[model samples]
Target: MTTAPTPVPTPAATELSGGAGASGTATPVPRRRTVKLRGGSWLATVPLFAFFAISFGLPAIAIAIGAFTLSSDAETGAGTFTTQNVTDSVQGAYWTSLLSSVKLSALTALIGTVLGLPIAQAVVTSRFRAVREAVLSASGVLANFGGLPLAFAFVATLGNAGEITKLFHLTDHGWSLYSFTGLTIVYLYFLVPLMVLSITPALDGLRVQWREAAHNNRATTLQYWRHVALPILFPSLLGGYVLLFGSAFAAYATAAAMVGATVPLISRSIADALSGNVLVGQGNLALALSLDMIVVAVVVMAVYLPLQRRSARWLS
Candidate 1:
């Protein structure tokens, strides 16, 4: 019987073992000192750090401080410090606006997910290439066409005595352009596209082999999706919903154009407070509003982190 040849270990392994240099002798590798960054390199970054500190951090910190500071009045000398600013914000219109914002965000997320899923399914399963391209392209265009332009389009299409109303009797009717429902519709227009973009990749990642295997086992299409597809797609859908919620929650210009100062969504309320028209020296209200917005953003971000982790685990 022939003996198998001894396998040679790699150089790296040999080195780790101290390299059998002589018959029984092992050569040791001299450890090199860790490299240290020069003071110049650290100094170079100071300007960049300073730039960010001045432009971004400082302004944000200033706003935060101002939100807690009381302005000088005839009674108060130059400046004063009090929690009344925050208290005032929490007790008044701010509370109503915050409640409205949260409600609208929930509605927008629901609408976007419900609408986008069907559209994504159409894009994926439809037979016609032209239709798919048109739908995708139109979604892209409309996603970018937010804010004032979108508002005007809605007005032109559905406003009182708009072209549609005059030509086709499509009155603003029960769907007036100046209501919370109207803003929800406008938000969905942009939000659905966002959902489509987010969820399409997750849908595309559903392997054909899995579907085929399920089918060979006599699984129906719905059964296959239920058992094999949805489990994988759920995390992504949840993540997308969180994202859409954030987007709609932060939206300002579109709500402004549509409501023109009547309805007080959080963003509109903040803008009004900041415009210095109604609340001149009380810009602190705007800051407090910003803080409220920040809280909402933080919640969304907190939810997003776990959803992202789930997505990564699923994808892996």
Candidate 2:
């Protein structure tokens, strides 16, 4: 009489049987759980959104609105909408200063682009990894190591009383810190590092095969740069230009310290307006100027959008 074989337990039921005795206890499987998001992520994001809006966006909006409004009368709490501020900004002191600022930014961008290319090329094409690492590290440090401290460093190095200046007896030929040339020099100190960082990737994007092919074709140095390197690196160069333009445009501290005189650069102008006496309605102009900055920032961002799109397309 062949009795039916004992039924084999299913995988779900079978456990503790690899080496343990039959009397050994089997472990129960943990129940699986399904978690569903309540679609509250958007709601959860409200606080952060509100915080930025109140802190940054709202203030910007208020400044813009103030830019378009006349100062409120201290006694009567009366004010009117006017175009004078905008007109003044366009036609008065702001226009010339704005032009100067634009010119300075353009010059700085050009210089940075021209100088940064070789440095970036060197950093990218170097066979020695240590050299590349050193350049990258130094670029990072120098890029962020500017402001008042940088100005002082320059002074200590090149000032009439400076060690190097004195060592060279440069006192016979004094350095002019208050000139456009001086501003440009200080700006280059900040600008070159930015260019190096910005263009390094573009320089790297130039494949060795392209250079080898160019050489095989008997391409001259200028020909290689014109035909092969420039097209590949154009996007990075444009990006570098934009970066340098924005940096020089919005620069405040270095220019301020170097100038030592109240030059009407946009940033200094804005600073003056903002730092006006609080005892009077001077704060209103400051708010107006802040809005002006917001407007300028918006325009700069607008310029950036097309370049970014082009870079994306090229990369893709």
Per-residue lDDT tens digits for candidate 1, residues 1-316, read 9999987889998988888864969887889998887787889899999999999888888778877777776455355677787787766678888888889998899889978987898787878999878888887787677888988998888677567667766543465667887778778889999888778778777778898999999999999878878777877888888888888888888888888767777787787777876757667778877877777777877877876777677666
Models, CA RMSD each: 6.6, 7.0
Residue-level lDDT tens digits of model 2 in 1-316: 8899899766544644433347775555567998978877788999999999999987777777777778768688567887666666655666667777778888988998999889988888789999999988888888787779988887788765778877888768766555777678778887898899988876765667788999999998899999877875676687788888988887888877767544567677666656652234544555555556566666876776677676655544
Write down the lDDT that model 2 would get. Answer: 0.75
Best-fitting candidate, scored by lDDT: 1
Candidate 1 segments exceeding 4 Å error: 1-59, 73-79, 125-134, 167-173
Alpha-carbon shift of residue 57 in model 1 (angstroms): 4.2
| Best candidate, TM-score | 1
